[model samples]
Target chain A: MTSHPHPAPTEAGALPGSLLIRNLRKEYRAGQPVLKDISLAVEGRGITAIIGPSGTGKSTLIRCINRLVDPTSGEIWFGGSDLARLRGRSLRMARRRIGMVFQEYNLVERLSVIENVLCGRLGYVPAWRAFLRRFPDSDVERAFALLDAVGLGADFATRRADQLSGGQRQRVGIARAVMQDPALVLADEPTSSLDPKTSVEIMELMAALSAGGGTPIVINIHNVDLARRFAQRVIGMSRGEVVFDGPPDALEDRHLTDIYGGEGWLS
Target chain B: MSEAALSGPSRRWVRFTPVERGARALVYVLTAVAVIWSLRTIEIIPEFLYDAPEQTADLFVRMWPFDWAFYPKAVHAALIETLHTATLGTLLALVLAIPFSFLAARNFTRSGPLNWIAQFVFVSSRSVNSLIWALLFVAIFGPGPLAGTLAIAFRSIGFVGKLFGEALEEAQQGPIEALTAAGAPRSMILVKGYWPQVEPAFWSVALLRWDINIRESAVLGLVGAGGIGVALDAALNNLYWDQVGLILAVIFAVVIATEFVTSFIRSRIL
Candidate 1:
């Protein structure tokens, strides 16, 4: 398991809250690696944006954190516990502390806005209560508050998710993620599907929420400008390897060209 | 360029060989000959051409002079009984189908052998017609609405279970993944992720089964299982054509009413 070589670090930083990845390797097929021996540390409460081209295993990397896509071999140490080794009840408990936002919104289309938002608390609540739509009063209040924070008012709660526009649905998605009251939030291309203005707004909202909650966020973004604007630290990936990791001021054109492989799209 | 070069080559028309054309013609001729011969052999002469319109008109006239008082006593009790049978059977089937559907759905149960067993049970239950099931139940349980109800219920389980399983399998994988990641038990995922997605489909299928069961229950009584079918059988046996006409009219009315009610319920749910 420990035979694979660790890839060279693109940058060095002290990541908070102690999420240490040591020699993480994932391969879908035998000897055909999707993720090579990737080692990194995520520390403290701040946004870390992972920027990479498509099919470079950015989404796969984030999903592996939550075990949505199980890693072939890795050690994810968070808060003195190895998340990879946990299973069943213990795994769920760990996941409740981790929130995730998707690019497509992935809201339950048939369920009402409030119900979909309430799903974030599914990890905390009893199964019977969640099944019956009998969410706790505090959770309900918090859900409504989160909705308001995301710019959707109380009236929109009763409307089905399918009835909402893309922006509104994504707002609900973000609200649901926040509803988990997670210690860590992972956003995989959160603004990829949104327009320019909406993307900025969403990024701002996520940055503000993470800041206010003191939660560490790891966001996978394709937009370098948005990432530079929002993220405290930007990690660049190419060919499943991190090529650059630093502050916006420290990043130059050469590094961008190296990461994305061309100067044509940079303009 | 020359006109011939611009126009390109003239394609050869591929025509069928003489033998092939003859064979095609022979097939048509044979089909026509067989159809005509079979029709004649079955004595399918159109007797309507020789029918007396006056006699049909007289029969209709007789049916119209209905014992209006008979409608209140005869239809009311039988209609209620039919409704009861249908409701009971549907409820029972819904109860029995839950576990069976879970077993049958490949998404729910990955075990090939278990899924096959569930499918076998569903197939066996559905393979026998409702009427035959009713007859068998009548023999076992003795003649009553119980036999008819059981028959309808048993058949409905197979129908509803198969449909429910399909609906269950097609539910969104996203939420299920989310729940699993949250460290939720399999049961929790089922309750949270599976139930919400499949509920409307389940209700829609159950209502459809109810509609079908109502009609089946009505006819099951013909085999002594108890309902309007028993009355229909009696009317036909006695050669009371007036009563038969009356019963048919009532059955038609009941069917239409049930259809309307079920449609209304279905619209509300979906």
Candidate 2:
């Protein structure tokens, strides 16, 4: 295990999961680009939040990094491979190293929480083993540990996923993502479906867990206050373009107005 | 009511337009004409119609004393054979239909040709009745329980496969997306994501088809495919109304018993 207890190197050093995206463009329809040209680099550690109005391509940008929503044209360099170009087995290998959390918890509702968390190890284990639910003992132990780390105790492990409330389900979601032992974790509006108090709690839990594991997070978030509070670095976006990229302190009301458009709601 | 009174131009609301009313009246007239035409065309002999009640009474009188002694000699073995045929056929249908169901489900297999082929198989299998299937199988397998079992199985594939495929198609996309993002292989996604969602529906559909297959296979023996229907056919040919009445009663009791058993199992399992 290369995971260190200390914080990752701050400088643009060779941290294992440092992502460098170059001129990424995506178009779902011919000549109608959803993401016009995006370029940014994320550090290997710390929470980097991308804030934007709905439909401004925050999801497109985050999904592009893992090649989930494939970029029409661009290069995403991470761990010595272009993620946009990888296909089949190689693509799966790259994806297994990056964990993602969704706005909806997205748990297999019929499965037990422990089994859902063990799904993270699917890419690493053989298909037959997974089919039989005969995961390695160490993987099972780690899954339990991750559930505990995500604020769910061992008692919750055997319960069906659908039995949990929204907050509890997201906790299971986070545990599942963390169970992958990812180098980078991407969260696409991870707290939108949550109530305000639970959203803050989830962000806090995510911040604590990822920081301790030295795993970097690139989260697409709509709640600007939550973003500023938890994100070390914030990238503000408008019309599929990044308008501001800096420390959270540098994100003034004017920048929020520019990113979200209009000062009507700022009051 | 106040708003309408204030408006003063109270309009009426009609359910159907003039054209729609005309169309409905035309449908009624056509249906009446069709009934009259069929009644006029049907060639019913007046003498047979007049004696129908007496003939029915005479038939019942002949069948008054059922051949209960036949149960130990023949009906019991035939009844057991019928059940085995139904059970084995249902199991076989489940085994064969599962793969076709996967192929037919649009979400599971994305290829158009595969879906079309699976649907084609289902349609052809369902179009032919089980008795016809028994006839075809009896010719191939030469008069036995094997023919009866195969007949039931072949007839059930379409019903079981179509429903199972629809169940697989209805699985939520959210869980599937999560598994895919986790870098799970396609096979793993099917096993972990889709299978859990569809398991209950699979069993429910299998049980339902099995229940229907029991009724179908009971009559397959009339085609020389082997079941209680063989005894029924022999009694009818030999003009033994009492034995025929006994077989019918036994079949009725067994059908009711199976219905209870399947419903109980379904409730418990689901």
Candidate 3:
């Protein structure tokens, strides 16, 4: 853990997708900070898991990266721009390079699966084109191919998103993020609502896809074991602060106790 | 100590406080008094009351011999005009209310003054009855289907806009957030996110409003705007009770038919 509160000029420009969060702070209410001065460096490639107890601001931290939840004061350096200060058109253009997945698989329930997957290209395509569902042929093909890669075949493409099972929906969600051709993907509790088996499958699928595309992924996950299994690096958080940052092997039982603050559930 | 406490006395749970119980009793008394006082003030004539059934029977007797001949010349055309007015008015209301609904929807627009203006329009439209709207439009447009259509459209704007706005507000933010995070513009997010979620609700509201407009439009002709009500009004003025009865029957049938059609369509859409 370098703990560099500032992004070194040399490393900042070194990678296309590398993220440098410097002294990030968020206060929903005056004098009450939910995220207090968080700083982290995520490399341009591979999976980085953020594991913490509920309400510890792991989701907030990941959201701040993509400007989903604005940081009160900080600098998020990505794609050679300050993601923190980006506004309006610039912000939207910057967001085109960062994709996101949600725990609920947040697809438009009434929309067809293919369209849901194609939604990732909404930023690149004109509004009227998206409205008319006249996505470019290349994007359509990429969407279908991503669907297949996520294990949803051509048969599932025409079906409504709501018709799919939890695992199937998550697959579509992953396909959508991949369809963005993003340099970075942020997943907020991507497997929190799934069953244990499905959760493991989703994690494996995410790992393989990110590795295949070399798109760096930062996941906010509650499952420590999944993080340890799938992530190259794990950052442990407690009470809105990063308490541990290292390889998964370095995350010891004592560290878990410190992160979650209870020994009863450790066993 | 625990055994003694358990055996001592059972606690009582009262549903309401003494003040609340007294208030409820007072409300009942006030309602009864208001009903009695209103009844006493609007005195019914004893002679008219005694002749009411006889008069009704005589009126029915006069209306009995049906006006089948009048259907082709007047009733049919007026009926068609009424339907056209209702359909057109409903369409116009839908088109106008859609933008207003988006404006009023807190989640969609996020502007306080715009929401207030939209809400004010809805309130003003709803406050004036369709008949009153017909009267106003009749003054400006001078008594025709156009006035009737305008009245129906104006009255329905509030009903459609308020309900559709609520539906837009109720749409889950998750999908919208997902679209926003995907770097989609505001319009794209609306197209992909809000539109899909609100489509069914929009259809349901539109159909319900159209059904109501049919009934309202039928009566607009009484105010000299063109519909079946105008025919009925003419029949009433000329002492043509039979034509009036026929028109009433037609209105009743059309209203019931529209109710069935709207409900069926609503069930399918929902």
Query: CA lDDT of each candidate?
Result: 0.83, 0.91, 0.92
The candidate with the higher DockQ, 1 or 3, is 3
The recovered share of true contacts, given per candidate in order, is 0.36, 0.64, 0.84
Per residue, candidate 1 scores C-alpha lDDT tens digits across B1-270 of 898897888777758988999999999999999999998898744676456677688777766655556557675677678778889999999999889899998988899998998898889889999889999999999998899889988888889999999999898887677656555567777876788799999999988898888888888878988888887788678866677678788888878988999899988878
Give the higher-TM-score candidate: 1 or 3: 3
lDDT of residue A118 for candidate 3: 96
Per-residue lDDT for B107 in model 1? 82
Per-candidate total of colliding backbone pairs? 6, 0, 0
**Could you tell me how far off, in angstroms, the CA of residue A223 lies in candidate 1 after the best superposition?**
1.4
Off by more than 4 A, model 2: A1-12, B1-8, B40-42
Better of 2 and 3 by DockQ: 3
What tens digits encode model 1's per-residue C-alpha lDDT throughout A1-267?
A: 235354333335534344777767788888988788788888767889998889888888888888888888878876546776777677788888788888888777878999888888888888789877888999999999999999999999999889998789889988888888877888889899999999999998888887887888999999989989999988888887888988877778898898889889877
Q: After superposition, how far is residue B196 of candidate 3 from its true place, in Å?
A: 0.5
Instruction: Please name the candidate that would achieve the greatest TM-score relative to the true structure.
Output: 3
Ranking by lDDT: 3, 2, 1
For candidate 1, the iRMS in Å is 1.9
DockQ for the candidates, in order: 0.39, 0.68, 0.84
